[model samples]
Structure formats: structure tokens, C-alpha cells
Target: MKSILTKPSSRIYGATRQAPGSKSISNRILLLSSLTPTKTQLKDLLNSEDTNIMINATYAFGARVQRSQPEWSIHKLTLLTSKHSELFLGNSGTSARSLSAMLSCYQGNYFLYGLQRIHERPLQDMLFSLRTIGTNIKHLFRPSCLPLFIRPLATVKDSIRVLLDGSTSSQYITALLMVLPMYKRKLGKGITLLIHSIVTSKPYVTMTLLLLERLGMIVHRYGWKLFSTCIIANRYTGPSFCIEMDISSASYYLILGLVNRSNLKLLSICLYNVQGDFFLVCILKRMGCSILVSRSDVSIYKQARKLLPLRIACHSIPDVSMVLLIVTLITACSISLSGIRSWRLKETDRLLAMTMELRKLGVVVECGIDFISAYSLPTSHLNKDSTININTYGDHRIAMCFAVISSQGVNVRIMNHQCINKTFPSFYYVFNSLAG
Candidate 1:
């Protein structure tokens, strides 16, 4: 479903509604659910591409995932009588890495594999730590990458410390913590997972802790980046839990306020969001877009200013690079963004994707290997309205971000809308609600 863009009115209004479930929380809970003896009923699991991958992977790992109408059930791995499992994590980094680290403790051979994207993603950090604890895990392909075969370790009698960046992806640290309790510490205490770098995207860690608590695991949160967890046997029980809204996916609509459309009050987003993408909402609004944030929703209305030029560091909010890059195209002038070196690791190199997509729009976007500067030239469309043909490089964010770029009175066609199935399946419909 390619989006046809047109300039929006000041009032892009709609009844505020709840978006889908948080991908981060859903994946983490699914991993934990498979490990605990509790019958976990996960509600509001995202009907997105990533979560669907997780759902299939849960069943592949030999867990009885009961699905009724909308919700799902993951019978605890502890309660399961089976000892053999081969897991297939489609392309989910969180699910693959977390499951790999946790399967190490089960003391059996469980092969975890995934698609090309997962094969391309880094798992060396997780492998190094797990191997330190005596897990017989090794990559089937090149070292530090995926297609890994896991053989059960004899026994882990030692605990280890791992230092990694929270900015890269909090899943690395959280993976260790989720499987940490099964390790042997020096004094017979629970496994100690320490983050040695200044953490970015701290909200994701918070989300992890929240789900851990819901599962009844005792996790102690010390400063911003520090957290410790121990295995409390019989903690995870199969019960209903609500998945939080996805602020990351919602940012596409939130950026509509920049188009000077409507003064909407009740947008379909929440205020206290644990997702890091929420900060982009505040940041875009701060740059002069009229944004109203409520307890369970956020409303985006246009501002008097045509557009505001912004310079933001994207190291912490790496996922928002698509939205931010789209904004750069709509600006009356150039905007500079820094700290984007991590784009190389995504399904596609997002940094390059943004540049290539911007070029399609006839914008002169100069991008170094680490940073990008895009200047929205005074185009005929800004004055006379032109149509935009958006080419999505099979990247979901590309498809989603182009929807935002389409709001400028230009009929935008996003080729390969199916690419959005990578993250948000409903992206076409949800984005159309805002595009209208």
C-alpha cells in the first residue's frame, strides 16, 4: 500500500486511541515466559512483523503458546516435560540473542537460528559472555554473527562481568541478566551483570525491568544504567499482562504537527512511555510543532511556523532516524543530525538508506560515514505542490517515514509497502489515518 501524500490541514484530528503493544516488552516477556514455570498470558502483543516472528519462535522452542482471539499463552519452559528444543527466531535480534543466552542454562542442545538479517546482526558479545559461563555455544557461520548451533554446557560454575553499550541496544545487557541467575557467582550469589559504558536509551532498560518484575523476578535498579537480577524459582506464572503502546511507531503521526494542520488535543499516544522513541515526539514538538501529550494519548497539531530547522544527536534514539530524516526533507532550510554511526547494524544500513531516499526527493543530503546534513531545497512542491514517488529499500522505517514526508501536499507513492511488514503490519492503515 503505497501512500499518496497531500498537504494536511491544521487540524489533523482524531479520537485519541491506544496503539499496538511494545515490541521490546513483548519480546522480552516471551523469552522469560518460555523459561519460567508460570502460564504467562501476554495481552496486547504487537500484531507487527517483529512480534509475529517472536510468536513463531516461541512455538518452535517447544513452548505451548495458546492463542485464542487476540492474546497468546506461553506455557513455562520449566513446567514442560520436554528436554529437546530447536528454536527458529526469524529476524528478531532481541528474541534470538535473549533465547540463545537463556537456552545455555537449560543444559541441553537447542539450536537457535534466523534469517539473513539475524545472521548479519552481531551476537559475539552474547556468545563471549555465555561461553565464559561454560555454555557450549558457537556460531555456525562467521564468528561474532548468527546461524549458531547451541549444545548444552556441562555446568556453569562461574559468573562473569560484561561491559557493553546501552545505546547500541539494551537487549545485550538484558539478555545477560535474563539468563544470569543460572550462573555461579564467586560467593554463591546470583549472577552480577554490570554495564561498563554510559548507557543510552535508558527507557528500554526500564521496560525490561518492568516486565521482569511482572514475572516476579527480583531486579534491583541502582542508577540509570545499572540493574541486577536473580532467579527466584516459581516467579514467572502464566497470567495476563498488558503490553504498552509503541511510541516509536507512533512518531510518524506525531511529526504531522510540523505540517501546520490541526490543533488536535487527544492524539493516539500516551504520556508516560517507557519507549525511547517517545523523546522524539517531545523533541519534534519542542522544535515548534503543537503537540498535546495526555495520560494515555498525544495530540499533534500544526504550528504557525512553516517549518523549523533542527540539529539533533541520534545516538540515543537510533530508531527515529527515519522520521528525523524525513523531517529534514520538509524543512524550509537544512538540518544537521549527528551520532548516527550505529546505522550499519540494522536490517539495512539506515544511514545510507536515508541518504538514498532523500536523493530520490531531489534533496542534497551530504552524509559522512557517521553523520548527515540534509537541506530541503525550495522545491516546486513547496510552492506549487508536486507528487513524490518514494522508493522504500525494503526497510519498514523507509515506508513509514515516507508517509510523513507525503504530508507536504505531494502525492507520495511508497513502493514496496510490504517492507513495512518487517516492523509494523498495520503501518499502512495507521499512516493513512494520519495522511488523510
Candidate 2:
């Protein structure tokens, strides 16, 4: 495995950078744009493996995608030319789940498969829901896993209702929200999604609903258990859309600025409630970090070396939890995160990966079924210039979070550092440029 060893910089200075486009928003918008026949230009789309998977998936489905780096024009294909096709989604939960659901609603036989890790992730919830909605689907490999086949609609009903468990992942909810409107348009019937439990990653589902509204789909909600979209003549339509900068991606820098005591400005960030990860600012405030938020930027600086401890539920911000773990070491404050049972279903077992890596730093870490608690050791206990080897496990978040540990005067050798290409391809470039 190729590894990159990052050492602590002797000096930290003020710097400004714009994070990559929001992966959540970018992928959501990409799938939504393809569902409609109207030609759309997506501005500031994230150029990463996952978004590229969505782009390729759409193109395979007949959308004419013309790429111009950050900007891509997509002309949605109006009809299906082939009856059978196979697609590969490389461990991208958003791409695999959402795209599979979208394909199920269409008239085709889709043999969806992906890398080994993608197969290991949970898909039973999504598969069960599709079967409930009268879609013909079969698990071609291990039962309730990926390497599945979705046949043409076996039956069309007057009212399509699928009972889905939201406790695992919200992409299931997002997938249904994006596809149901198209189902309504095609079947001349309303769609209802009955969420069986409290939705995990509720904020991500909110992101999807917001985008659905932008595409002219009005989804009526009955608390968290139910979402209904009344049948309408209007089809999905968005001529042009702009994706926001990735708030989750900016989280590494936010914690870095605090730990390194650097004056850093994150540009092109809109202080919006749409992305749950943007709540990191609130966490920073609780940590006693000096944070200034303007219209389009967030400036972070260290107020004090010692900081208050934190215990947060990570269900809404699972992707940010890895970075938050690093904060414990930098601040010498206890940080406990809960509601992260879904971590097991991600690219790798993040809960386990983080626990193992933290223990290597001599920090006391405890992990449970849905929680991880890290009690910090004093900064004096850390051996400065000591190199710690981090196995990235091919998970992007794991690699990026550990990279920031170098800011704390500890060197980190991150294996498979290129795992970041899954989301933030420019992570190391931006990280290196911020040092003086």
C-alpha cells in the first residue's frame, strides 16, 4: 500500500481556501437533474469518484453528459433504448442506493453491482422496500446484499407505498424521494413512503427534500414516519442548478485551524440549515474556539489552548464524527459521540477504525454498539515527532481525519491516502498549501 507520511509544520499562518462542492448536494442534484427530460447545467459539481459514478450511471441511462471540469451540462434522455444493463457503483452509498431505486422505478432490467466493500454495506432495507412497492428485484449474490438484479416492473399499482426502515441509512429515503416523483409522473399515481423508524441521518433526508422541492416536487410529511407526494402533471424540471461548497469537507480545516492555532478562512460557504454538517460551527463555539461567520466565509482562530469537552450524538452528522474524534487529542478534552451504529455499514467499520487509531496515540478510547468515547491524555504525554501509522482501510474520511493529527506535533503515516479521491480529491493539496 502506498502511504504518505505527514509531519507537523513548525509554523502555521493565515490562509484562505474553498472546499470542494458538497458531495451530498452534488450527487443529489446530479440524480435529480437526470430524472427530468429538461437539459440542465450543474455549476460547481464535485469532481470525485462518487460524483463521477453518478455521472457515469446517468450517462449509461442515456443522459448526454458534457463535462467542463467543475461545470457539466446534462441532457436527460426521454426513453430507454435497451432492456438490460449492468452498472458498477464503487462503494458509494449515495450512488448505489439512490441509483438503484431510480432504476427500479423505470422500465429496464438493471444488474447493479459494485466493489467488494459496496457489497458488504447494507442493501436489504432498500431491496425490501423496492419489493414492497411491486418492483421485481432479486439478490444475485449473497442474500440481502448487492450484486442484485432489478427486473422490469412486475406490477403497477394505483397507489405505490413502500415501508422502509430509516435507522440504517438515509440514502434509502433520499433514493425514494427522488424516484417517486418520476413514478408519479409515469404511473399517474401518488406515492407514499412509510418510514418504519426514526430516520438516521435526518439532515441528509432534509437535503433531499429541499432538492425535490427545487425540482417542483412537493412532498407532504406526516412527522418522521410518513412522506407523501401527491400525483401531479408537472415533471421534474430544473434548467440550471448550483451546488454548495462541501461543509463536511470543510470540517477537517475547521478543526485544523483550532488545533494548529492558525487563522484560516473557508470561502464560499453559505450559512444554511440545509446541510447538517454546517452545525460544526456550533460545536466549535461550544469548544470555546473563536469563530466568525460572514455571508460567504467562516473564519476560525484559536482563543485558548485548553478547551471544553464535548459529547454529541452523531446520527445527523456521521461523516463529521471521524474528524471530531481528532479534536479530542488536540484539545485535551474528552469527546464522546453516540448514535453512530451506522458506521459499520459505511465504506469500512469507521467506529472500529477510529478506536484502533486513537489507542495508538495513547488516548483512552471505548467503543460500543452505537457510541465511542475518547478521553484525552495530556498534551505532555504525546511524543512530538513520533510517527503513528494509520491504516486508511480505503475509507476517505478515516484518511483525512488522521492527516490532521500532524497539526498536533505528531507525525501520521496514512496508508492509502488516495482514498480521499472518493470525495475530496484536493484534500492534500489544500492541506499542504495552508502551511507557511
Candidate 3:
């Protein structure tokens, strides 16, 4: 459906839902496994548009993939021909950035293009680092944008080093890191990465480092800024791996329960995940939501009479901040989230999209490059009787977060509702189930 209308509810109660696998871990593992000569079987990989893009890209790069429900076998071909190839990555930033770096290592003519919005996202910072290592790239349309041709030179450096500005996006750092073993094998030594400025998403980079460590690669660091991997494994060789549940997706339901004062239980909740968005639980607790966490389940219900006004930095939990912003509207409480400049670089310009939409709901919204604050406006400025139509701007998180308004006695119409396919394809099914 292009649009979905959710009817208002008095309250929601007694519901349970299973969280999806982590998209970050799933994509990283998909690429890492395809680089290994050994066969790697991944269990519980997220079945979504973003992961499917990675899967198709791996197959296009000559990796053999066998699909079995809940398990996928990926075997890297002994030889990947340096033939001409064209890859079309949807608006998945993870796929576009990481695949660009990985394809740069191969001596081939590869054409890369994506959807319209993806073309607007920044690729210049990552391309500059790749070009420093002698990777040939031609930007087709705009500078620092997508629709490009990449051809690596037919030479291998004996030793290599490059500098990256850490504040750009953690995905750029992760893109280079994931392709390090290939450089290590070709160069006969580990490549050194000199990072300048503060890393924007340190937790995500930590996730990359942890995954590299899982592949038995030894990354040595001088203090926190400089990183280099030991030439231990020329290729990854993990036989089988399980992906952790996505805490980002879980935040939607948890916040839904808090807004509706409902009894909701989330299944397969992992407390020890490397995903930084797990901090949502702590944020909810701080907001006075009654939450109970156990080995594999989390329960949320009514406890607090009201959600407290929150002022918090969103650098570590950028993905779920959309739902937190929605909480500001549902509870009619003030919320100010900072350190989210990266949102401007996501699938859509989230900072601008959010500000515009919040204003439509009679919220007094204020925003800059790095922060957004919202509070309910005066009663005279409110439109209390009409349904709110939320334009999602094709951002999956925006569509999902606005769906929660139904529980707050507001009818909500979500435009481009199918955009949730980018991450959680079954979101509406689950949301409707919980709404029953």
C-alpha cells in the first residue's frame, strides 16, 4: 500500500513479537564470509531488501550462495575473474559504501549506481581514501556522489597507508577495514590507517573491529586513533555464525508499549550484543518506563504516569532516535536529541524530514545540523480532531515511528508505508498484531 491508515486505540496490551536479526551484523558477515575461500553458513540472517542487496552483490562478485530457510551457505570462488560487471545497490548505504571498497581491490571494470537518493549521499570521503591506494575511480554524475566506474590499477604496493577523517561516517572506516585482509595479502604487509578528528560512530567501528577479530584477524592500534591489522589471516574463515537480534527494530515496539501503557514482551532480546542501539533499554528506563529484562525476553508495561522530558546525545543511538522523537509527540513532552548530524547522510535527509513532519503535527520544532528539539505547541495552535498524515520521505524508520501515533488516540496515515521493506518487511504485520 502506498499509504496506510491506523485507527486510534484506547490502549494496547498483552502482546509479544520476535525481533529481526541485526542488519549491521548481517551485512558485515555476508561480505566477510564471501571473502573467505572456506564455506561459511550464516544462520538467522535478516531477510530484507538491504541484506538481499548484499546477497546479490556477493553472487555478482562470484561467490556461491545457497539459500535455506534461516541458514545461508556462502562459498567464495577460488578465482573471481576481473571481468566487466555492473552493480545496482538500492538506497542501502551499507551495501553501496562497503561494496565500493571491496570491488576496488579487484582489477576489473565495475560500474556502480543506485537509486536517486543514494546518488545524493556522500561517497567522496571514502573514494579519496580508496584513490590514495591507487584505485582508479570515475564519478559519473556528481562529485562525491554515486553512479561511478571503478578500475583498480594492475599493480600491488609493497606497503600501504592512508588517512581518513574519522568524523565523516563510521561506514567509511568500516568499508576500508572490511577490505583490509585483501590489501594485506596483496601488499605482503598489513595496511596502516591514520584516523584524524573524532570518530562519529565509534560503536559501529567497534562492531567492525570485533567482527574482524572474530575472523581471527589481529588489529593492532597505537592509542585509539591509529589502527593496523596483523597479517595473520589473508582471508576470513568462519565456518558458521549466528547474527544477534536487531536492537534498533526492537526500540519501535518498546516505545510503542510505553506510549500506549501496554503489556508487551519482546522475544530473543540479547543483552550482550555489540550493537550500540541496545542503549534504548537504558533510555527507556531513564524515561520511567517499566521494563523487565531477562535471559532472552524483555517485558514493558505501564508504570510511569508520564514520560519525562528528555535531553540526550544521539551519537551512539542514531538509528532509533526517530522513534524517540515520536515519543515527544505522543507524550506531548519536550525532547531534545543532539549529536545526530549523521542523520543528514542517511537514506533520506532525516534531520530535515523530521523537522518538517513534526511541524505538521502542531509541534514547535527546532533543528540545526546536529540536533533537533520538539515540544507541543499552544492549545490554540493544536489541531486535535483530525487525522495526521505523515510523509515518510521513503525513510523506513520514519514510517515505522509514525505508526505508533495510533496508540495515542490519533489516527495516522503513513505515506510510502512499504519503505519498511528496507529493513523490516514484516513491520506492519507485527505492528497490527500487537495493536490487536
lDDT of 2 by residue, 261-348 (tens): 7799999886754889888888988888899998889999878757888999888988876788887876678999999999988999
TM-score of model 3 vs. true structure: 0.95
Lowest lDDT 10-residue stretch of candidate 1: 2-11
Error of model 1, residue 400, in angstroms: 0.7
TM-score, candidate 2, is 0.96
Model 3 regions more than 4 Å off: 154-159, 377-385
lDDT of 2 at 175: 86
Q: Write the per-residue lDDT of candidate 1 for residues 1-436, one digit (tens) a residue.
A: 5543434432355534446676787888776777666577777777777777676666644576777767777784534344666666776777777878776766566677777877888877667766766778777877877777777675555445544555566667778767765453223545556666766555666777767676667677677555666656444555677777777776676666565465444333576656777788767766777776668667777677766677888766777755766766666566788877767777678888788878877788888976888887643445334456677656777778877765555566777778777667777666556544
Better of 1 and 2 by TM-score: 2
lDDT of 2 at 39: 87
> Which has the better TM-score: candidate 2, or candidate 3?
2
lDDT of each: 0.67, 0.83, 0.83
Best by TM-score: 2
Badly placed stretches (over 4 Å) of model 1 are 1-18, 60-62, 77-83, 163-167, 184-189, 221-227, 231-234, 263-268, 382-389, 434-436
Better of 1 and 3 by lDDT: 3
